[model samples]
Target: MEQLMEYLLHYVWQHRLYGLAPLATTDGQAVDVIDPGVHNLVNSGPDFFNAKVKINGMLWAGNVEVHERSSDWFRHHHDTDAAYNNVVLHIVSAADAEVRTADGKQLPQMVLSVPDYLQHNYQALIDEETYPPCYRIIPHVPPLTVHNWLSRLTVERLESKTDRVQQYLHRTGGDWERAFFITLARNFGFGTNAQAFEQWALTIDPQQIGKHRDDVFQVEAFFMGQAGLLDDTLVKAERRDSYYMRLKSEYAFLQHKFGLTPISHAQWRFGRLRPQNFPHVRLSQLARLYSERRADFSLLTETSSLDALRALFRIGVTNYWRTHYAFGEESRESDKTLQTSSLNLLLINTVSPLLFACGRQRMDEDLAERAFALLEQLPAERNYITRCWERAGIKAAHAADSQALIQLRQHYCDGKDCLRCQFGALYLKQGRS
Candidate 1:
């Protein structure tokens, strides 16, 4: 599932529901059918009208090309009645032979005629292994439409973020301080390192660490000690040894100063990652960020972009980390810069949602917009869910569609509740009328 999310965005974007023909009365009055082609008219779903659609003055709707055999509709028991009665159209991408309704009514069948434009667009997105469709799709999307769509998406993204933050507030019994600590911890490693960081925080006592803020060294010691970097004397053989030794003594003094509990054997992994990304270093940086910036959660609402958020988090590492990755000083340059990508992930996963959550509480539009603008500039995400649609022959034209597809899949397809998705229902109504 973790791996799938990494590439699902692109797949879902391509499979987005295109528009369907709207229902109409013989006298031209619009009639809402069991399933309307609402999304299709918006160019967001399969291009068929629906079951029970009137073609050439005759009411017709039935399945087109759902994967199973025609009889499977009966096997799935659509023959049992209501599903059959409203079906005016039948659509299929492929068919073994002709199909009919359970009552022996001859249904109008329509095979999908995926536009050449759609096919070409889809093929272009999936062929490359690196650099997702963003670069390619960006050129094709109209600049005007891009801005308009992003403006809307930015709002939607922020609203969603705000909702999550509210829930966190409730879950934590409305303690802003605890929430801030959690938020800081979450930002420590961004997405990939977030869970580990959270676990590290959970194992350490917050009260013990909170009291030592006056001496920033004590705060640094608590975090490093909690991270288990001060355990071995042999670890001192490296240049970082001196730094860790000082931090260990400082933490010991601070722990006694504030009755702090020592950290246990918490799991931290450095394998397959660059040295700069080590959990120990990241935890140190996180502590430093908090010590340097003493603002309430609401202060972040004022930040305009992910870069601004990064600037907030960019407290220089302790004197030790400046010279060494673990405990050894290096002759060569070790990357001390916080990764922008990691910060972006923090905005996407933690900051944006939390900011939006805060905005909802205060009903602040500025906070919402600020959080959303950060998301808009992020490169379009690609994932398995998006690829499935790409394989099915639709293409993502922009980040707006990609995010929408992700939302659709997470909220609709995975739930097997197409009725909730305007696009999915439109697709099913046409594709499996």
Candidate 2:
């Protein structure tokens, strides 16, 4: 007998992928599968429920329990469990032994073997080295299939982010502005220091920052101070840099007044990051946005154009950041402006989702449609997932396509959960009726 997972048997039974001729119980009663029942996604009591079958010309309807072998019914104690009493049939790959209900009634049993091609195809997915084990078939897949699945995946990706947005709202006491602040802050970390940025965002009193929001310098003080970046060590290192001294001194006074505590400076990551992306610089740029642009939540809900949203995040860093990547280290004066590409990323990862979430919360379909429209208009994001998809005979044309590809990579490819993936399902169903 071939080694098998019970899930594969469930897949076989649910899809009616078994010997086409006929089936019989252990006692040789003629059998026919009417319906295999719904597969229990929650993995509850029964493997499947509401099944219908015919045995010895009698119609029976109830739950179904599948196992690699009928003996597992006993090994798992289902024989004595009342949950199995309603099972009209026990389907297994092997009929190792008989199964009886808790009331001592023998249940009908049928042996179902996996089609050799299906097992071979599934094993190739599991054993293949490259991602998307179905790479070979991607080009040949119907274009309509690819389009529809990607469309569904893009919405799924957006919905998943909406949950995180709701979490931020819960943390902010239903304050949309503060929730947006935290979400945008996390994205400012640009992947490496995102967690640290989110942690820092939670530490600040958004109202207190709002009070001093007019002064960009004070905003920098609050931002850097809460990030735990304005230390005495920085003051000492940049003793001659008056900018560093001013931020540190102002932060101390504000910290005492607001009863604020900062996240450990160690939380910010610097290794392998460019000077422009350093936490210190990004934090400064964000501070400028708060004081100058104020990036109101209303902007996201009302703003729909790619250009308009990009302009919103284009708030450049103050002069201090224009010359320094770190507290003490003064580098050549650079523009220090948020690049168009980085702006696009912030729009894709932060703004669009924020808009969609606002729509969902407000029950305004227009805002949600605007969110989708934004991605459709923007260029595709260049990232590992998109690159891999490009290599596998598909290329993303815009942010929507790229976002779907990203969802596919994270939710399916990474987990090898191809059994649930639309593309994976198509790949498996190839050549089958």
Candidate 3:
């Protein structure tokens, strides 16, 4: 077993799963645990702080230390560290040595008695090959339990996204509009090209783009040019269409005027992607969005209804893009408008998180609530993780549920952090019963 299994021992101790039978120290003195104390500490001290226990009818309250073996106390140099001076109890899986404080006072030691079934169950979980070790038991868990867990997970997922938004805000010197633009640009890539898009956004100064926001053509030229899509060699070797020529010329003037450098065109991925989602097409749509909305995306956060948010993102690329997915390649006439699914994705991954972060920064609960409410208004995402949940009989009804499942899969299930997950804890608790 990995050394981290000690965390499972910590979990068992915290929950008092060692049964109600009278406990004893290695010396055979009767013992009782009144309180297991706080196990989660931000700073280093003891494994658990401020514990209350009764030994031989005497109540003692102090810090508690835990280890896989009692000798770890010395191996960890607690014998010389004055920080462990007041430890009242030493709980270890095996008591192989005597422990003492810096003052030479022998500390009481107890061999934590975990139930046999709990040990077997934990071993079975760790040895299981499935994504979620307890997948077989998921369907058996109470629906209310699953529902409550998912709700909490949804908040956790949103908070995680909001954390990234805060990082962007910090990098942009707390400029909300610039941060939102960066986030929106990143999300416009959907998934395959998200990093490249984010890198592109970081390179371009949003203030420069704001200057030409009134002119869609100029905005498109600037964005496409900075993306390196209007490379002289590539554009020249291709069709050299009139629109392409204009963008090349405009970008040449803007490049020198602003001292701008374009990102490598190779950063974008086109493998297996639909033409509508091509970098060229998405950049055009993003240009139109900026031209229409300008630097003020506060309207996105202030919207009262989901429909209003949907309407705000209901934009399409220019007429030239309607026939061309790339700079020169002409295609059949089709409306390259943002589809409902793509719009929902952008709202979920970009707009909602941005609004949530704004609300948190500005202390506006209504905006954060609206951000969460918007997720509930959209359909659940269909992805591999969600499919796994569905196979386990946990069907998501909305984006909130889908996001929560993603959090659970990525953070808890995949990491094998069952000891910290409520659902995993519930399953283990049921097994003990």
- All candidates: TM-score: 0.56, 0.89, 0.89
lDDT of 1 at 21: 61
Per-residue lDDT of candidate 3, residues 1-433 (tens digit): 5265467678878999887777899999888899999985458878888899999999999889888888998998999999999899998888899999998989999888667777777777778886667787888888998889998999888899998888888988888888888898899999999999998988778768778889999999999999988987666565888899999999999999899999999899999999989999999888888888833577876676777778888888898998998877889987788989998998899888887888888899988887888889899999999998888789999999999999998888887788878767765765575
Q: Write the per-residue lDDT of candidate 2 for residues 2-100, one digit (tens) a residue.
A: 334676787788888786678888789998889888888766688889999999999999999888988999999998898778999988888889889
Cα lDDT over the full model 2: 0.85
Q: With candidate 2 superimposed using the best TM-score fit, by how many Å does residue 266's alpha carbon deviate from the native?
A: 1.4
What is the C-alpha local distance difference test score of each model?
Answer: 0.54, 0.85, 0.85
Q: For model 2, where is the 10-residue window of minimal lDDT?
A: 232-241
Tens digits of per-residue lDDT, candidate 1, 219-260, equal 777887776667774365545546667887887786677665
Q: Any runs in candidate 2 off by more than 4 Å, and if so which?
A: 1-4, 24-35, 42-45, 49-63, 71-90, 97-109, 233-240, 430-433
Model 1, which residues run further than 4 Å from truth? 1-173, 202-211, 233-240, 294-296, 305-307, 329-331, 381-423, 431-433
| Cα TM-score of candidate 2 | 0.89
Better of 1 and 2 by TM-score: 2
